[model samples]
Target: MNYLCEMSEDKSANEVRKIIHVDMDAFYASVEQMDNPDLIGKPIAVGGSKLRGVVAAASYEARKFGVKSAMPSSMAARLCPELIFVRPRFDRYQEISHQIRAIFYEYTDLVEPLSLDEAFLDVTTNKKGIQSATLLAKEIRERIYQEVGLRASAGISINKFTAKVASDVNKPNGQLTVIPEEVETFLEKLPIDRFFGIGKVTATKMKELGVRTGKDLKQKSIDFLNQHFGKQGLHFYNIVRGIQYSKVKPNRIRKSFAVEHTYFSEIYSKRKILENLEQIALDLERRMKKKSVSGKCVSIKIKYADFTQQTRAKTVLEYMSTKEEFFPLIELLVEHLEINKPVRLLGISFSKLNTEETELDQDKQLTLQF
Candidate 1:
């Protein structure tokens, strides 16, 4: 059923932001095949041979067999008996990512990387003096193929979120453009699950709320959404109406260090929830140590059996880099939550970050003063 609504007064149809999203097609697997011709046309998964390891990337051939990234190696092997597992070469991926970024810089310096495989570029004004963002997308994709020896897909839209969603419309090296006037029509027919910020859990919740399409989502009152979903509710209210104002934030700072655990079975016990939270906190601590950074805010995310999720966060007086500093705060956050329903997921993230300070040598401070 199509959910229908009149255009909200908050939305505008002006095509102000010319955004392009470029996504490399099956990047890691494709790179492996490129370097080793024998692997071409074969079903391969890149991650590792370890049975417990997860698939980091799957070739198109592997994907056809229901193999996918994050699938355990053992399960992938079961699904595709001939699936070849290759260790991830992150160094190589980084090198290739640099090459792609160089190509982007040649066109526009407004590139914002989503990952090694995908990025958003605002080419409303470009270095090449090109007027059509659509044409520039085509050129960038061609350059990636010719110079980087990889196929890339492009999506051109009025904004970043729509551009990101459009890029997935025709995958494995294709382009789609959503023009200024077509934004509403484009979003109206799109599935709720395909909306940029909505995850699987959120999509399921939306489906339960009779919000199956962007049109359906638009029908809900902003107050009703905010009452149920908090700040994200307002975000959904805006996006469905094509009201996103998020710019392509270049050099976006890392806001949080997080880790989560999805339980195989629903967890009902508060003690078990705390245990899981502790492990996640320890993992986050390790990650922060490795990065040599810390933050003042600690947040706990909980997803219930019904797939409804909530997060509670607090900013403390001092930088928190270890479990000892975060666990108590997490405990306080959890105390306020209603965990009557079985918990499906638990996570901890540290935000409002700061780099740990090292005392400067007195002589260095004096030299700087001089």
Candidate 2:
């Protein structure tokens, strides 16, 4: 069924900004695959194998043989003897990226492109004039698939830092979101390396300092972190606590959200699963409030014992009005369940929020996506 949300005019509501990071899957390689049907399943490399030349893109198949973009062509050749190298088609790839951007503009005027293959968009006030960010995302992805014939992954969050990282998690045509309400727990289970700004050097130092996940960093005093990393200490302190007040700059959209949970003995009970729903609901609610916004739609995600996952969401009558009110509706949704199998994880999301700062147009366009 098509996803839908109903939202009243939130004229009194404060606006919450968003940053969405989008990346083309295998970029040039994917383009090649789309152009030539034969290359779809083959180990295709779009670049030179000559001395000093670099690979631009490698199909997923080619990646299995250790081929990677921006890597020396010689290394790629040495790793995969059967690799089929193709020259870069600048015009074609550029055309594809351009088409993708046009779709983005449909959502928001605040678009900041990172590179030919990636971009960040601030959809607080979308051009399509839709209020639900998730629904807009679904529409965007569908458009890219139909119009560009390429798969793109997206990461969405209240800020740029986490959103950029979220896009890379379930890559190659996947879209993920990290709701502000769930930021803390989301970061708690997150690996340190995945945290924004925790690069190789920082990651090493973080390990030494006992700062592993965002939650671990939360344990340290802000002053303590400042002593070790100087200005970055304050930065770490904020992000670890999921306090990314950062805006979705039009020029630098990176990626989307990351969400996972810890399990005790890999649970598999419906009642227990419903109980966990409250935790995820709380998490999502907190993240949303921190960003000073609410979503118009709620989704319940389930991960079964076999690792199979299914998600169901209903567009709501309003943005998350209050946590006290939101949880019960989620409870009602849980009752609609009919999973005959054991459950592992249960997640709930409030999306398609009316959080943008724009005058409500009389010509509202209703769409089903969030």
Candidate 3:
């Protein structure tokens, strides 16, 4: 099923965009390996080894043993017995990220950084006047290696969605290009689970409906999709046909800062819940302080053993950053929560951030469709 002819007829798709998504090769784990020569070529996990700790990132060697980010540290250790765990150095990572972004600005100002490790660059109009985005991506990756001492991978395509997905096709210091003509076949053959935004739950639901691939998804009627997925139905319809319009916004403001933990064992006691909340509050405070931001709203997220989740929030008169300022409010919110069910996860988030007032411009805040 080709979409090129139909896309060319649409005014919104008239402009042929050139976007490149560059993602670092296992960023956190790679940084650890680079800094410490002794850790080279070894399976390493960057995170805590304590009980209830999650793997923040895993080196490629560790990944061979099925260790992955967000996996329980104990599970990761069980997977790879020799996996060396290293603490994350955010300050060091941020320092390196700044240097990498500087390299991106040399080519184009339309750089949308998704994280410290990956970003989308709209090189349709660039400072270097580079016409071939594939060539430009190669150059950028090469520059990142030469200047920053880190290997990077890139994907070049007509839009950000396809570009981002294509980047993962050839990873760990490699590049891929999904040209304008190839986007249709590329998406059609792709598994529904590999469609970037689709998670495990959604993919399982798609499979249950006999939609295992993009080809299968394209066969379903818009009405049928809407009935099942609601508003996101149109999103699936458009993206599969290569019709994403989300631009690479230069200034992407973070809306909130949160800290969450899924416990190794469920906590049924109120005292245990409060103890966990206090620990989460300390982490949240440290993060907020590092960002030098405060918020008026404090929220607590609770997930039960049954996988049901609930959030309780309280808004205060003034912005607060310290745990002391917000912990009491968190305690108050927790007091109202039902404790009949065992809780598997607990989280704390600060919203209505002070940074929003200073950094946000309503007109520039474009919602990413994907």
Candidate 4:
């Protein structure tokens, strides 16, 4: 896809920020392939087996067969009959993630981790004194591969939104850069669905409204967009114009800790569901203890086979961290759920944490600082 756009003569006099978004290529699947030499170049899925499991990640080879993460394993197996399924090793993934973050610290401390596999970095004033953001991205990617044996793709631009969208343009060990002057045209031609916050549902809605690309979106007035998308309409309005000002915050606080799992098959038996919930509780307890924090509220999420989901939460008088202390509460919560239908997923989470409580506003919008 062509990413170039005609440059505007009058560039903004404001200080142009340098942002880079780095995303690991098929992270979990890649790790599986890297550790297992025999799995190289083979179509493998890092998840559960075909009968009753869900896919966590799929290697590029498997992707050719239309397999994807979060897809049901049975469908993935049908798509690629030769697909190999392997369980995810999150501990190992976390270990490697730390190594990659350390490399980012070598250049800039303004690293904002979105997940274990992706992050946003602000390197406008990097410690390395590198004038070119593209070169810095290349160096970071090279270091990750050489040191950690994983391939990564990067996108370099003047802001986080453009940089993030550019990262996916070239994938599986490639990089893309969207210079400031080209940002307008680059966004105009971009597919509506390709924008960072627009998902399938919203993209379908936009297409129904004759907004197929960024150019079409830009044609709508802020009032029109707001009328349709509510508050997010303002977000859509600004992003299409390359007007994003969200900073790459390095020290983002963690609000909650949770653990969840999708079963290989629909579980009909309450006893079986309880068994799974017990294991989930144990896992969550371990994570809480590791962080040395306890929470007053316990929450459980249940997803039925029909794709419907519900969450139930209860707050206790005192902080609790042990499985023994919370498992009974979980049982009580499960009793209230509509389990007449078979359950496909179960999760447990702890909130109202004993750690410093920061009431983060979910809808807070950020503007340009300087």
Maximum-TM-score candidate: 4
Judged by whole-model lDDT over C-alpha atoms, candidate 4 comes out at 0.88
lDDT of 2 by residue, 1-370 (tens): 2101111122222455666888888989999889999888899888765443457789999999888876666788888888888887878888988889988888787777877889888876777777777777777888899998988888887767777878888887889888878767777888889876678999999899897777788798867987999867777776656555545455331122113343424455567776777677667667666666666676777766455788777676766646587777777777887777766456766556554412133124333221
Q: Where is model 2 more than 4 Å wrong at Cα?
A: 1-15, 50-52, 251-370
Q: Candidate 4: which stretches are off by over 4 Å?
A: 1-13, 316-318, 356-370
Where does candidate 3 stray beyond 4 Å?
A: 1-11, 50-52, 259-294, 302-310, 316-327, 337-347, 353-370
For all candidates in order, the CA lDDT equals 0.85, 0.72, 0.88, 0.88
Structural similarity to truth (TM-score) of each candidate: 0.71, 0.60, 0.82, 0.89
Instruction: Residues 1-370, candidate 4: write the lDDT tens digits.
Output: 2111222222442768999999999999999999999999999999879775778899999999999987888899999999999988889999999999999999999999999999999999999999999999999999999999999999999888999999999998999999998998999999999999899999999999999999999999878987999978778887788876677889766677889888767898878989999999888888888988788899999887667889999999988999999889999987876678888899999888876443333323222332
| lDDT (Cα, tens digit) per residue for candidate 3, span 200-224 | 9999999999999999999988778
Error of 3 at 275 (Å): 7.5
Give the TM-score (vs. native) of candidate 1: 0.71
What residue pairs are clashing in model 1? Answer: none
In angstroms, what RMSD does candidate 3 have relative to the true structure?
5.2
